[model samples]
Target chain A: MTASPTPTDAPPLPWTCPFCALLCDGVALARGETLELRGSDCPKARQALAQQPADTAAATPTIDGRAASLDEALDAAARLLAGATLPLFAGLATDVAGIRSLYALASARDAILDHLLGDAIMASVRPLQDRGVYYTTLAEVRTRADLIVCFGTRPAERYPEFFRRIAPGEPRRREIVFVGTDTDPAAAGPDTELEAVPFAGDAFDTLALLNALAADRALAAPPPGPLAGLAARLQAARYAVIVWEPGASGAQGALVGEAINRLVGTLNARTRAASLALGGSQGGYTANQVVTWLSGLPLRTGLFRDGLRHDPWALATARVLAGRNADLLLWVSSFDPSATPPAADLPTIILGHAAMPPVAGAPQVFIPVATPGIGAAGHLFRLDGGVVVPLVQARDDGLPTVAAIAGAIAQRLAAPASGAGS
Target chain B: MSAPAAVFELRLRALPRFRVDLAGVTPLALGALGEAEAGRVAIRHGNEALALGELFEIRRRPANAPALHFEGDLSRFDRLAWEMEDGEIRVDGPVGHYAAARLRGGLVAVAGDAGGFAACEMAGGELAVAGSVGDFAAAALPGSMDGMRGGTLVVRGDAGARFADRMRRGTAFVFGNAGDFFASRLVAGTIALGGRCGAHPGWAMRRGTLVFAGETPAVPATFVETGHDLRVIWTLLARDLARAGGPFTALPDRRVRRFAGDIAVDGKGEWLLPE
Candidate 1:
């Protein structure tokens, strides 16, 4: 609804947004007759835009799913969701401003809001959440931390600049330790220690190592090579950091969680320990941010119930499909649709943005929206914890902002309930 | 009353074997803990720390039988109480593995399920779990020959595989259906199942009993039924479990079937089933 590119003859500057983990920052788009999407010099964005359907299809969505008057599409999306019992409005991290709108909608519906990495984010923060530890920003890692531990995760696979960010700046001689999975030590840059521990199916192995270390025992154990010595080193460290991937530990519950957090807290009792969540999905932090801000708990909370209940083995779509918890899946992801849905058998309603394919039973509602960095200008918080970066703009028009769409939907939804203020 | 010194607070983070300022503190004062801050934080002794938030999250104060109340996702925090002396702890969410690892005394009640090593190496204490626990619960630490010794461990819901491996002493019971590998080496203790029991239960038992009250999967490998009874112990256990919130606590009038286990051994251990 903003002024059209003024019918300029030359191409207009594209707006880039880094809200999503993608950080695809420059793109050119507009709506003359049909919605158009253009990517900057970014290869991935160009490929995605080119893959968009030449024109809008009858059933499936194209580059312009919300081509209809933004008001009309938002109204339909809102009215449809407002009446459902299991309404789940999620995947709002793409645009920070839109998060406010999402909060409004979720409150109004009393619905379950989730993201791709529900369990992972919660698990990453579980230890600190339970034992009452301090919260540190990524800036701490870049400066204060002398040693960094990445257990069962590789940041390069997603956040390409992870090493540069965490190991960048002052002293530059910081040491990095990667544990759990096997990795070629040479690949990680200078002086980084990569310890390979045979992958066990469960996290109790870590506990075993801790026990060996804390007890100063070493009888040629596999996972815990030199427990006693390790414990001593850990206890004597000035500021040691331990980090693990989300799935490194299984799901969370009441008791086991307390036990795990206690373990972490005990380890950190003598030193400083913090975690770096890779991302919500492949490495996105939006899901983590959204879930924390809303439920006062992490993702995978059974907010669908009156109070936010936590049943990891149950609530997850996969677990539910595994015949662990209730049915009727409501999946929300900010990625391509044709991509795999965690639980294939359960009936689902997949809400996402991207030129992706459709999954069976899970009715795919394609939401044509702007790419964080490539299509719009906005602030993008990275997964290093809190790395808020301003996205450079590149797109011209027709690219509806994710925040704008979320806002319209919230407005339409609140119309029936609280009216104006809502 | 003489003016009491101002209360000091400490926020508890979700970490196993987590030790804080409450070493000599009373439960009445401990119950003031909560989960509010972001990133696994808790309030503690005014001095700001990590994990959860500031100490004394709970605002209310209660007398006698004071309890330490925890509010947050405790799945990562293990060892609910390590050699606890006294008092009680109530967690709002599921706890991580080894909840109550080596619990010495007092009541540790969880609003949700627990993790592995539940009451592991427990010398003396009482733990009540509303949900199921992970493997090796109430069992000894890996490589340790003995399991629970002194204390009572009760699980209201089902348990994972290997319910109780190497039991030494004490009593461990489940109200609902039990998991696989019910009981391994019965050194000297009692494991009573109110519902179905898992396979290979009571294997290599020197003494002690593994009881099944409901439908079982494959009762096998050196275990035979003994006799039925409505003894005073059953009445006492039923009353206690019921009062602790059991589905059949109010109806303890029914007869309890007794199944003697590992006849190869002394066979003094007996499993109590609902007749």
Candidate 2:
């Protein structure tokens, strides 16, 4: 049996740029209109963007799989939602603003507006919004941090350029350390320690590390060779960082958060510490600065019990979805809703921009708006507790701001609520 | 090195400064001023402990030192306060985790994504997303729970899993998407998505909001919407979100709808629909 030549003997695909969720930001266009796969970015074109096989997404997604006029596509989408009884207003989540618009439509129409993250992360985000906490961002890490740790997370594919901006060789360097198994081979550098602990005992590994360094005692997996010595290094570090990658199964996710608190508690005893997410591995999306500026909450609430409660389970988005609660669906998402309750069937109304490769099903009325980061100007809060990034909205066909749209809608809804607000 | 303490001024982008700490100090506790007290007010380092000027040339506070700049070797540091009340700090290169931990005010544009716990337990700040971030990018520390209180964490790119696990409050947004089991144990918060997210995000989330901007398969634990999207009031929140920097900031004055629940957790959470 001839196995044929490997990629070494074959030619490469055109190009794939995972710059956006559509994973269509930078794609390869062949001379014959037959596009080739781009590099690492196009996971769906290679791996999978929305559970749809790479080959499935590689079919050149269009509303109907055919190149139709822009108007025709919009009309078709409108038709789908108009006639759909159980229409779910879904977003591709390629861009945050686009999906938000769809969410508006979902809210107005009581449809399901969701994307991948909506399902994977939002479950917890819903409740967290009801609570609150403190944090920072990547921009802050660039020049501020001195220590970094890779927990149950990896930053390889999602943001390949991640290392270049924060590593030692850069104009402003920071320390690095790995606490999980040797998953990200590229993360290891001469200056940092990439320890390979038993993947199973990750929670215990973290506790053990903290105990040995912070409490001056051994806990789990006594850490061998360089790791044992690394404990002393960690304890002595003036500014230290910790990173953990939960890996494929996602078995250690729960422990990651607790481990972090413990690590920070211990590290704060001497040196300073900070953290960031590896890529798509997170539960909630930090809202723009305004949300927090006013209510001290993200999309939910922020009245914590002294110690900010970032617990989503407590708020119960699932219960809300199933209970058919909420007088209105205010989906102010930077992206699309990532989750859908098993029994969710709500009337969705949309009020934001529309992301392309629309979510499955249709909405009653879908209005496309401006891509905030691209068409308007605003302020966004970074992951770090207090960093605020100025948003530069690009003027695209003169669309009103999401705020304006929402304001107008609010005015309309308030008409009845206040009996005369409108 | 002219403008010593310029309050309420955001002078970034044009020209920034990076000031390194000569002495090892917990930058998180120490304000940006303490970290930047180089030149005139230096700290104790190794040997004789030189001043900030001795170790790294202080650009001086700059008649307008564009807020932030890169100073010394930060390879041995942590808790780089990327978030300043006002002003900027430029890290010419890579930095550590909690890069700008607990940032509450100001603009921080990172050239790269930070390490794990990058923005754990943050309150209020605008963290730019030029690159990507690690696990819990804007979430809480592993055991000692508590997600970002109130802040915005935007990721221009994708991220690893467990993004905002055990989050109590705040919103963590991703321009791209993330890996699996993302918001598993979320407490309360709103997680919006711009891209397709990974799998098993809200496994055991009790109460929180999960928004999917991209297409994804259905989750078994999650029940379909039992109610509907609340278009009218939803616009208010959506508007606020957009103005706050969401891509949908420019949506029209339409209605909003709502859906709810992870049947497992009382089924109270929801998905806001747009019309």
- Say which candidate scores most in DockQ: 1
Docking level of model 2: incorrect
List model 2 lDDT by residue over B1-275, tens digit each.
33344222212222112122222222222224533553445443211233544444544332333354544334323356634444455554445456666676555556665555566677777666556776666766423557676777777777677787666777777767787767756777787665666655665466777766555435432334435545554665666656545444543354544445443343455554444
List the candidates' TM-scores in order. 0.53, 0.41
What's the true lDDT of residue A373 in model 1?
44
lDDT of candidate 1 over A1-422, digit per residue (tens): 24533343545445442423435334455434333445534343444445444432332332223334444555545545543444443333454544555555555555555555555655555444533433445667667766665555665544444555555464445455555555634326554555544423334434334533443333232333433344455566555555445543443321223333343455576666554445543223655565567667655554543356443323444433443232233344333433445644433433344454554444323455554443455565565566555664433334566666666666665564624222
Residue-level lDDT for A122 in candidate 2: 38
lDDT values of the candidates?
0.52, 0.44
Name the weakest run of 10 consecutive residues (lDDT summed) in model 1 chain B.
B1-10
Cα lDDT tens digits, model 2, A1-422, are 11212233244423322222112222342211122343433343332223222221222213423444334434444444343332332323223333344334434443333333333333223222323212335545555666566554555555454554355544444445555545465655555545543332444433434444454543323445555555566667665565433233144443444445555665666766644433232112323223233334333221221222222321234433443333223233322223221333443333333342333332222344444433344443332324433444322334445555544443443344433211
| Chain B TM-score by candidate, in order shown | 0.71, 0.71
For each of the candidates, give the backbone clash count.
106, 322
lDDT string for model 1 (B135-236, tens) is 777776534667888798899898776677677888887888766557755677777676776544664455775545555444332234555445777777
